[model samples]
Target chain A: MAVTKPITRFTLFGGVVVLLLCLSVFPSSGQAPKNKDLVHVEAYASHKRVNSGKSFHIIITANIKQGFHINSHKPLDEFLLPTVLRFNETKGIAFGSVCYPKPKQVLFPFSPNHLSVYDGKISIFAEGKVSRNISSGDINVSGIFTYQACNDQMCFMPESVGFDIPLKIVKAD
Target chain B: MVAVGGFLIGIILFAQVANHVHKIFDPLQIKNLVSVKQLFSAKIPEGVPVKLPDLIITTIEGEQLVLKELTSRNRLVVVNFWASWCSPCVEEMPHFEKINRDYQNKNVTFLGIATKDLLSVVRKFIVQKEITYKIAMDDQDKIANAFGGVKVLPTTIFIDNNNRIVKIHKGYLSQRELDENLKDLLH
Candidate 1:
């Protein structure tokens, strides 16, 4: 394993998850403790290859790490940051509206109202249609998932995870 | 008959929404549960104190506070980054308020900085919690990024008399820890 200065890089699925640890702040004698990840996201297309003019759903799944939760796309509270996903349109690909799963509400000691959040595995689906003009090849549909993850007591900074769903286009027979 | 059916469906939907909000009405069940609290915090080792830049921060009440003026004349400054949405930050706020009250006119100033939070929410929170210490907003996380990007909530930075950041504590710090850190800085 190649060791990099300061930053310890880990490859999650196909993306590089760069976690800036607080180890550098501690003394040399202090042992570094393992911190938990707030959330993990991965995405894939319903059909790896699709016929021209055919439609498919792009599935994006976010797994909230144990002991953490992220606000839903439509958080019930006005003060909360809503989780959002944006697909960067590529050539010959038409994107449709993305669907977000309903969030679970949990009552904690902090707030008087129940907080709408996503825990465990939650998937967001987006519809995409392939254009008839594209030739048979691989095309990358890039998107970014933005969320603010929080545990029972504290919340981490808002983060955006970028992903790509590659699809192969075949001419309609 | 149609009205009755619509009312029944509405009741069912309301029940489903209520079920999602897990509220334990039975206080007797609390004994069976174990409270688990986890935090990743560490002590900052002695290093070269970074020269912290002075900036202007506007409070929710439309007042401005300058970092350079607060740190002038060898005064110690405590800047705590917190948000109303963060429960741990709310829990740790009282300790800072206590310390802020204790350090009045003692060459120590405690300023609570809010980032990624709503002004109205913060205002309601302060009033509800009776927070009297000077508080301000760090727009676009400018102050947080300046202090090396506070990734976690309730991150506290201590600046000594020399206008340099001396220590940084991450995560929930208890009142005892706050007292200990202050004792070290004072003497």
Candidate 2:
């Protein structure tokens, strides 16, 4: 009986080791889906302080989710909503035409035609001028970034992200 | 060892307890779990049987539809997932309508499902575009998500009289592709 005891223990340990190996091979079915956000927008002015009546640059960057893309400012498809950026009328700042970044033309598996789209991250630049009549003080300028994000298969609803940029006004340099 | 056996038993007991809790408290989640299971098991088959749950759809024409019921009645169902904002979807809709008309006497039902679209906007757009097929809004996007997440607009799924989904085409279907696919699947 004593001699058989070691063999019994060895057999039990072998069974446990085999079970552990099988369990490790067939792991859990992956994490549950979280309705993750698709896009984030950030904006900043070129200079910390710009003199009144002088021109400064406003740079805006859109970070799109990995699998999604947005139509360019000038998309080839007429029906697609093009990304548009515009600043609201403000007392301190006035804007000029925006310079949109170049877009990648991709022929998706689901598209018959190649689409001009912006993916990953893209930066947009615009020239803003401080009003000559405005006093030297901190000013807030609001703007909107509008886009429709889509993956290869479906497009999300068109949405807009608003940005408020603060500028420090000073005498002309 | 006893410890290993206990661990295995614990996992089994925990799963059983969670299943019972869901059955008692949240029946809707239990229903969704079935769909999720079916989704993984199903592949858009060119030959094999594609099994799906009987999901309810309320069309714009105010008629309720059950996909399994329609297929069981010796009718083929063509479901197109589309949106008003999808340009390719809009472009190919007229072609879909023409094919729909061609199969008037045939045992085929064409349902245009507008996904991620406002009901009012879709109604107005369809009227302006002269779409005559049965239209419905997938407001919650549950229908599209079931058919392998319809990652593209203008995806088409064909269910046969046996209630098996035979084909799922993702992308714009030209008139020729639409006609050929319908003909091939019909016979």
Candidate 3:
């Protein structure tokens, strides 16, 4: 038994090295908190007139995973943070007000007691008026979105998301 | 004596291992420590008085309360916007309650407004938390909009005697922050 002491120490050292190596090799996947949870955005036009001076619509949607809900554009309590969407206006392009979808009420253990939020998916619609004199072709619209996602346990810090949508413009009738 | 020494060493090792495991599992503690450090080190914006939009809300007792009325008593009004489902709001309630009690006679008034929430829930939360400060329900979120549209839970607006907005704090404020704000306002 006395002769085996050095061998045991070597085994312990080897085990620690293997554990460290495994930890270093397997980097964590930077997935959003919930599995299969992600936010998606899309753009559409009421009329396909993709012409200069034509009005187009952009709808940004966030699809939450099952059993999870995102904070509402307007939370129930004044102290609860409200979700905000930011847009950068481009030359010759005019952006309209953002229309937020209605949120559902939720209950939790925290104070003033209940909150309002959107579960599964929600959409924000905005109208963009194209420039009247632009040469017909592909037009790019872009903006940044800043919002905070929260669960029953905690609220994540606000995250900024940038998106660009391309549209085909032609002559308006 | 040797056995006792060995037992103590084993306990020490067990404690160390347990602590390491706990640290790995508890990310909330790390987040909280970072927030605490930010609270202590961040530059606190200076309190400035600005006129706020007028708002009226209904109290739990079914009385109409106007924002302007709070300014009549030459009091420093602390308006805390909170909901029952916000953890930071819950954590900070006791501190506000304490401040309300400690400065009751010091011309300081604390008003808690529940925005975008049901009145019943706000009433229950107030009762459960043993909050003695005046609490009102902003059914339409009008009050919140008047306060520059709060972007976070536990956002507190400090109003001076003249009903001017003196400070706007966003996020879960520590007792220390509240104490300092109160000290500046009270004096």
Instruction: Tell me, by TM-score, which candidate is best.
Output: 1
Q: Model 2: per-residue lDDT, tens digit, A5-105? A: 98997787576556555544653342211223787889999987889989999999999989888889988865678999999998878899999999999
Clashing pairs for predicted structure model 2, backbone only: A153-B151, A153-B152, A154-B151
Q: Which residue pairs come into collision in candidate 1?
A: none
Winner of 1 and 3 under DockQ: 1
lDDT of each: 0.74, 0.76, 0.67
Error of 1 at B15 (Å): 66
Q: Which candidate achieves the best DockQ against the true structure?
A: 2
Interface RMSD of 3: 10.7
| Residue A155 displacement (Å), model 1 | 2.1
Worst 10 residues of 1 chain B by lDDT: B31-40
Regions more than 4 Å wrong, model 1: A1-37, A132-136, B1-42, B45-76, B83-108, B116-149, B158-169, B172-187
Runs of candidate 2 exceeding 4 Å displacement: A1-40, A63-68, A88-91, A102-114, A119-121, A133-137, A151-154, A171-173, B1-76, B87-106, B118-130, B138-187
Local error of candidate 1 at residue A27 (angstroms) = 8.9
Sort by lDDT, top down from the best: 2, 1, 3
Candidate 3: regions farther than 4 A off: A1-10, A18-49, A65-68, B1-87, B95-187
Q: What is the DockQ of candidate 2?
A: 0.29
